[model samples]
Target: MSFRAPHDGELLKSEYALRGFLPKADPLTAFPCGSPYAPLDEIGRDLPSLLYDKGFRSYARGLRLPPWQTRVSVETLPLLRLYYVRIGFLASAYVNQVGEEPVETLPGNIAAPLIDVAQRLRRPPILSYDGYALYNWKRFRKDGPIALGNIDTIQNFVHMYDERWFILVHVEIESIAAEILAAIANVKRKLAQDANADLNRELWRIEGAVRRQVETLKRIPEHMDPKLYYKTFRPYIRFFDGVAYEGADTAPMQFRGETGAQSSIMPMLVAFMKIAHRRSILTDHLDDMRAYMPAEHRTLIKEVAALPDIGAPAYREVFNAILDAMASFRRVHYGWAEDYINRRTDDPRGTGGTPYMRWLQQLLTETEARRL
Candidate 1:
């Protein structure tokens, strides 16, 4: 089903429900004027940065405060370390393919082999929503962290693949993929458990809980808008950057810095195409493998091979179109950059007066150009 924006009343109702109290009568309304349910400054630090507390005198002052540090468990730490390694390897592969200088910290040349190993070690596991289970349940949750404070509106999941299909891949890949996810999840879960135990045992639980409540109070009352959520959350979305590339004689090598939507959209487009090709090859091989089988099994194998090439063609076409669009978009945006600088004394956002907004405008221009 297509997404529909919530009405203001719906947003307000959701916020009220999530907070576990009526809006006006809630203890959060008391603030500094009365004995607050929790301390204001302490709570401000615990709340998500996107939210603002109505009671807080200065958002800047709140921002300047030190953030709470949660203890990381050894089990969880290793998983995080592995995640970093995976990211490094992926980055390296991209860079190597692009024929560029590899960054020292990232695993520049080992990405493909590492990912292959990961794929081999995979297993299919049931998706769980347990907070203590780890692996970022927030990613799978219907309402994400954005809904924590405001409660009125929830952000939709914005993963590149369809969740159901992606889950199916895990099932198809089975054991290896499942094991990888469980390993990661287990680590995160243990870490959170350890942290929580430490907080409780050390008599810090009261302080932490109070601080969290206070911060919750301070956050902006507005429901999260999807566009705003995307803009704010874009940076945190993982993209492997700064891997070295080995030169290739045949393939075109293009290197460009990407941020915002392009950073994610580009890599996803590339990965989707690569996966499509792999699936096609696998399907073909499965067909060949069937030829050696008994007549009954052979028929079954052919049937499997004949299953529609679901995403391969569509993803390939979409990616190519995006690339074509990007080329024209880059040219026009660069043109605007030149024009804007010529008219202005100082470059705002240090982008020569044409930031992402100009680039996006150019993308629209390219789309129109394509229509012509």
Candidate 2:
């Protein structure tokens, strides 16, 4: 099958270079105070304390929150991202904070801004991976590496350090994804020209990056206690099922939670590596997750997916190594699910609202079978 090449791969390369995948969703950013939007900022700054107080739901329901009805300007995108995070966190807390059962409706004040920002951002209105992880961190020191201990979360539902660690672990993973994204950027030109040697070189680079990503991902349990993670902060970001928005014209929305599924790293890699997962309920959920990622990232995955297959013998080995790294990530993830979520409850649905144990097995088998 022939794929038409973009000019000089500029569109492809520049898309991956945009850094939307990083914490540059802005640590230095905040909405201006006492403006119409100040309520969200104040609520965000007060989230941890407010969550502990039994009055959190009352306080959330009582807010004179902004409608944010104006068309979002391109210049305000960074601050807009911060707006989504703060308001999204508050909304999650409102739903899951101290309820007999998680709330089924978002009040008008809470729903309006979320519906607005999420539509403008081309993602679901709930707190998906972007709000919960990618944009959730800020480096403690300006010059510090974006690694564990150096990074901390900007927002949380609880006061535990495990919450911070859980979010930061994903932040660190996103940071390592830069190298893999760079390798992907280079491959567009190689594929366009049929430069098999260069393509093979990039396949190796991607394999190394995946291995490094796995190494960093393995550090999740270092400071995050599984019980703390499962019990305290996890529920705030759990999936939305038939949840209605009070004032918006929108009907009840069913979106996945703040999940690892929404991360673009693996989806982009699966697309780039030419690994096609079998069609199943799990694969459909995986495809649906792209709707919650940044639109440019979704586009990039499609671009990478369109690149021709690398099926040579040597290319196959590098592909297998990358799959090995992916499998290792999956194994660690399995241990996490077992320790953090599965053992703790009888419910089969994970935070992402999938029967993940069965899904993961399918994933492992598919990855092994798709080598070259």
Candidate 3:
């Protein structure tokens, strides 16, 4: 098998080619510029300014209710909004690539000029939601969403091939997760004002969304054949090494450590599961791990930590939903790791090969079997 290195033009095309996905511009109507949210390509250039604009600030502050609402909203909601756009762009590329009757590299005519701006700024693109703050930026937004667009999809297919399959899964979970957080915050404010407020209705809304997103995973096994993921996409993931070519190179190096979404996202989900059990497990490696999560997410974890234990039924529904999502994510990666990473690779650490992957599968399997 042969792989071509990522070229600059391909990167830009993947991120900015939004014309078809976006509605055509109509200049005569009110707000005739078209939906601000449409033509998602422009967001890479526009989102940072929008976040700092005074009007956006006012819109963010307007969401704060009950005066006692956690200040986390100032950062969390807006950042999550930004993530929705990124996920949509990545998903569009992924669905179009894989869903094509004949799967092929995005044709050259369609793949150039994709958004590779982050590499020019000397930072990785903010593809996964967890580590946006770490990237180099032209203008800082202070725990706000990074303005980088991830054109990794435009690179050699390996960088994201199978991972894209799971990322759409992750994106859905995070997308709906933003809604769940909003509902929970709303319920908290309502309860603060009136102790007898019917929070069940609000909580049930979150539970239903979570359950539905989890069910969406049933489609994964159909699109992602294990052999395909192992042979095609799995080889593209990198651990460390920051090559200078960056976007033009498929295996650009990393400065920190490995940050495959599979691992980075686990700690956040685990934090929620721990909250359901009324256990706090911060101040260690777990705390270090969560630092990659957005400030809003970190703040929400702290807020959940503060709630008094109301017994299982009080939060059981949401807890189960989160747990189900976490377990399902683990299940897919576990299968991938076992089938590929653990199969024939020799141990570089000298203990054994892929021990952590085996341990993770065992742990997740055991956790999923537990009753709430």
Q: What TM-score fits each model? A: 0.21, 0.92, 0.46
Once fitted onto the true fold, the runs of candidate 1 whose alpha carbons sit more than 4 angstroms away are 1-55, 58-263, 268-354, 363-372
Candidate 1 lDDT, 1-372, residue by residue in tens: 111121122212333223211111211211233322123324322333312233322332222222112234543333322232233222323232222233323221333333332332231010111000111212234344323322211111222222222222212221112222222223223333442211112112222322333333223223333233333322222223332323312222222221222111222222212222223432343223222222322332233233222223323443344345434434544444344332443433221112444444444444335321
The sequence of per-residue lDDT tens digits that candidate 2 reaches over residues 49-145 is 8878877777788888776655566666767777889888888888778444787898888888888889888888899898888877887786777
- Candidate 3 — which residues are off by over 4 angstroms? 1-166, 195-198, 241-273, 276-286, 312-333, 344-372
Q: List the residue pairs that clash in candidate 2.
A: none
Full candidate order by lDDT, most accurate first: 2, 3, 1
lDDT of 3 by residue, 1-372 (tens): 111122122112221122111111211111114533333434333433443343532332232111111223433433323333343233223222232221123222112222232222223332323322122111223333211222111112333345455444443344344445555455455655665555666656655655654565444564466676644443322222332222343543332222333222344334434532222321232344344344434554555444333225655665566566667656755665565556746642101112446455455765576437
Ranked by lDDT, the better of candidates 1 and 2 is 2
- How far off is residue 90 in model 1, in Å? 32
Name the weakest run of 10 consecutive residues (lDDT summed) in model 3: 20-29
Tell me the lDDT of model 3 at 297: 42
